[model samples]
Target: MQLGIDQDQADANSRITAIRAAVLLTRSMELWRRERLDPETVLINLAVIAITSERLMRGGLDPKHNSLDVYLPLEKLQGCNVASIAAATGLNRETVRRRVKSLTSAGSLIRTASGDLALPPDKVQERSAQELVRRQLEALVRFANESLRDGVLMLSDEKG
Candidate 1:
């Protein structure tokens, strides 16, 4: 039986991409679960999106406002943990706390604690560029740690 082109493509390209994607997705979920990311964390991600979009717009390009960005900074900043959420979203502390709480109760956010909130996994996945940037940061941190370790080893070798 001859399957459709999608089936054929799935059978072929899927082998490579699917496993990688699944593994990456699992890792992301694990991070989210273990870290219990707050609304501020999600807001930080939105801020990055906003900054990127602003840069794009300034570079002679048309950039659309991310819905999350618009909501967090403009509307949803009131229900968060004030200082922390404000620091994350660049909004006023009182505003962030209020808005974050409302969003959390409405299921627009994943509320881990009175002081913490995060965008749902679906929303986070929808904004996968943020995740990619985070992965890049993780890689950089790992590289830096390795370099520091190697430097220490070299120093010890020289001493001994």
Candidate 2:
């Protein structure tokens, strides 16, 4: 097998990325399990967070509110619905609905008048959540460094 770095090695990149992603997901599940969070619930929460992040990247958000200490205002978020979450995550709609209901009741997630769901500011501000983000980020950084060293991607040589 060709182990040396190849810049055009799309297959190698896919395999490496999948491995790194699984490690992150497993570590996250372990942390969530210790917190008594169901894996499915955690997965659903991740989908919601991912959707919110996409909006942030698109700009027009007031950054002050979208911090670890606070979440974007419901009105300022496109948010996510159970059906949408299920669609995006490829999870069963009923499963997403059940978890969303439970999370809302437990105050882990907030529900808006538009039937959209979001992670609450209080949840984001939790010490455990902060710790989780830190550890996960560290793992991601390692993955990035490894990928770069393996030539999975690179900084543009050309000036933009």
lDDT (CA) for every model shown?
0.48, 0.76
**TM-scores of the candidates in the order shown:** 0.29, 0.78
RMSD values for the candidates in order, in angstroms, are 17.6, 4.6
Per-residue CA lDDT of candidate 2, range 1-160, in tens?
A: 2233345754667887678768876876787677777778778888898886677778755767656777546676676888889988899999888888888898888887787788886777888888888887887777667776767756554544
Worst 10 residues of 2 by lDDT: 1-10
In candidate 2, position 80 carries an lDDT of: 86
lDDT of 2: 0.76
Give the alpha carbon lDDT tens digit for every residue of 5-80 in model 1.
2344445555554555466555544555444656454554455345334434555442343433332222222233
Error of 2 at 63 (Å): 3.7
Give the residue spans of candidate 1 off by over 4 A.
Answer: 1-81, 113-115, 126-160
